[model samples]
Target: MTGDERTTTVGQLPTPDRDRARLPATLTRVVWLLWALSLVVLGLRWWRGEGWELAGVVAVDGLTVVLWAAVTFFGGIVHSYARRYMAGSETIDRFFGRVFAFTLVVLVLVAAESLVLFWLAWLAMGLLMADLIGHVEGWPQARAAGALARRHFLASSALLGVALATLWWETGATTVSGVAATVDGASPLVVLVAAGALVVAAMVQSALLPFHTWLLSSMTAPTPASALMHAGFVNAGGILLVRFAPVVTVEPAVMLAVVLVGAASALGGKLLKTVQTDIKGTLGCSTVGQMGFMLMQAGLGFFAAAITHLILHGFYKAYQFLSSGSRVEHTAPNGTSDGGTTGPVGGAVVVLTAIAGGALFAALTGKGTALDTGLLLAGLVVLTVMHAAREVVRQSDVPAAVRYGAVPLVALPAIAVYATVYGAIEGLLVGLPAVDEHAALTPVHALVGVAFLLTYLAVDTGVYRRSRRLYVALLNAGQPARETLLTDTEDYNEY
Candidate 1:
């Protein structure tokens, strides 16, 4: 049985024969009362002016009520379930104790938020949210299960707290400009040094050679922790590079360095993933490669591409963790091969994708570049195909036509607006004497032309095929030389 199966079984065992022990009806009433109070608070917040101070207070107090309600409801369920499945001298008290501690932590978070420490508030939310999910369904305990859960949960929270605190302190001392000013006010030099440190740190955490062990050590963490790391935290390193894009662009040396690290991580990460047998291990390395892509985009000033990659990868990684049961359930070797199935609509993504591809082709070749009015027709085509195909692939009740067509159409206007703004900015920055509006359109045309070419190459034979094959090879290797270095280092040190 998988770890998940074992836990579920422990939670699911029927309540053993026992004299009817009924909890007071008053307790149930109180739980309902708290839930009602929370809703009322939420309504009042909406009714009142959205003042930051008032809203913050309402949010804090309201969330407290909500947390209390959640604890009462879920805590009761866990107690009964534990009583049924977990047999030992250690039963009811331990479960309540841990639950109580968790509730207290929630209370502390509320108070912190009231103080306007938004960053701390976010960190606390993330940590508590993970723990709540992990312990909501109580499992049987062989020995001190409650204690074990507390220790691990608290340790995870502590780690999160420390990391965030360090970040807050480090980022607090100096603004990006201040850092730059230190090196003769040269933004390039500042970005070079700062981004260099971030790149090194990111490489280490991403499990690049000589630092791959952390990924394995991290696997022992709960699945939620793993998910957060994969989806966001691990990518923070690369994201940091993007966040500093304004500075990096001015710093030629830094941009080149970013390119090198991104290339190496992308190559090395894919190779290492291929060799990793553990599910989470594979995820860690995959993140390394994904992060590399984002870093490369940053280096190349492709902010839109980096943002797109980040959002998509985040959801995908999180869904993978939540659905796969995180090595807890024993079914498939690779998590993807088993676990929860998406509804039927998920199965039809391929058809929708083909439609999208066709639309993309039409848009690129259509006449009148610069919003290319014909592309609207092309997008419509893509939308139609997606609508037809989404019937089987999308589980939403919303009409696939409305859903698929709406977002891209909205995006078109936004992209055009941004493009216009970009053109104006270029005109201002580089005053080409007597350059008319039509002449100013040159940059936009050139950019679109380049993008069109690259898109074609990505789909075309030769280069695209080689890139995919290389990506696959690297993903399988688990890091080209990291494994060998680890083994050799271990052997030599033992002597």
Candidate 2:
């Protein structure tokens, strides 16, 4: 039942006291009503001969409303269904409530992105949404949960809204050049203003250093909230950076500055991840690292590469957070599990489909950008394989279906497809006469990749050499891995 442990009995989280949990219910209804109204407006606009393209976009925007409804309604329903099973457990109720709150925030975001122009407003509104939901669900533990939610809501919303608005207003004034920026012939003042806005945004999102403290502190919230932060909110830093790329991309110096900052965050996350003892802290550091990669790709003018990495890594990390408790159990009980029903064959099918889709897209685009795409994809494959290998070694008792076959089976093919495509693209790009930026991928690039790979390999080997008990201890140590500090909330007893 504790926050630190990884196992739970059947029907652990469920809904109860619905009549008393009126605030979340009221908020849910309000959101649904807004969604319904938005749909009707979009429908009427389409009927009035707004361009079909615009209408289509409206429908896509409706997706956010639907996502919100699904998460909230279904979570509530699930709680109701399990009420009897969870008869007396406020812990489980609060847990599900936190999840519902996180889902509410995500829905607001995706919905806002669909509308494009309303993003600042969405960011603003989403701040209070989680706290309101937490207040409702955490009725039993109302004081502590509500206090945390309020602080989180106020701080995040204020920072996000102000930073984004500042960027939009200042950057809105100028024209730039290059792949990322649209404004051209920007003045020094403009550049300085834009840079200031970005630094503020970076600070707000906890890009690195000081901003990172918020993320670590958020671990005190519910498990699902922790998962949401690691998987989505934390990842927003890289996404926001890319979103602002238009302003930052003009100056090579600025681009390098952004990349250097991203590189630092990545290295910090990696080093800290090595020492993390708590599961949430481990995941949090990993997220910081992933965001760093996204920012790096954006700085490289490989926008699509960054998006690809973000989508794939975000889903997997989220799944990991949601499934952490399941992992401790070591076996599927009943039919309920956090992982998808996808068995080994299903996993293979998913991987193959992804590869095939990538090939198809490359063929269609045929615009020579595929080479960058292929390299990014190849790097993803390398990272994925290494991660699976690490897990296989750490959790040696995973299901035979996954442990022996699925991991290697899915990973090896992905690696092969990515490597082959990357190598072919590189050879073509390099061997072709009169290609621009040919010197970009010189021996230096190769040396850097090799050096990074070797460093990671050494770290992996060291972990493998240690006994499981020692490995577990190292994993538990978290950020200050070398120094074993004791915290009452952390579960040192289990390890």
lDDT of 1: 0.42
User: lDDT per prediction?
Assistant: 0.42, 0.47
Residue 416 local lDDT, model 2:
54
RMSD of model 2 against the true structure:
10.3
Winning model by lDDT? 2
For 290-379, candidate 1 gives per-residue lDDT tens digits of 676556545544443444455456667766765554355565556542122324444345344645444454444331234532332234
**TM-score of each candidate?**
0.41, 0.57
Candidate 2: where are CA atoms >4 Å away?
Answer: 1-15, 21-182, 199-210, 328-377, 390-408, 412-451, 463-495
**lDDT at residue 319 of model 1 (Cα atoms):** 62
Clashes of each: 22, 14
Count steric clashes of candidate 2: 14
Instruction: Write the residue-wise lDDT of candidate 2 on 1-495 in tens digits.
Output: 244445524453454576635544554455456456655644554354331223312223222332333334433433343334334554544544544555555554543432233344335434533443243342333333344434544565555455444444554521111212424544656655665556445544543643454455445344445445555555555545544555556556665555556655665567567766557777777777777766665555554445445555655676677667665645446865223234455445445544544443344434224444234434434544554544453443456445545555655565555445433323322211212221123343344345446546556545533567655653443332121223433333221
RMSD of each: 13.3, 10.3
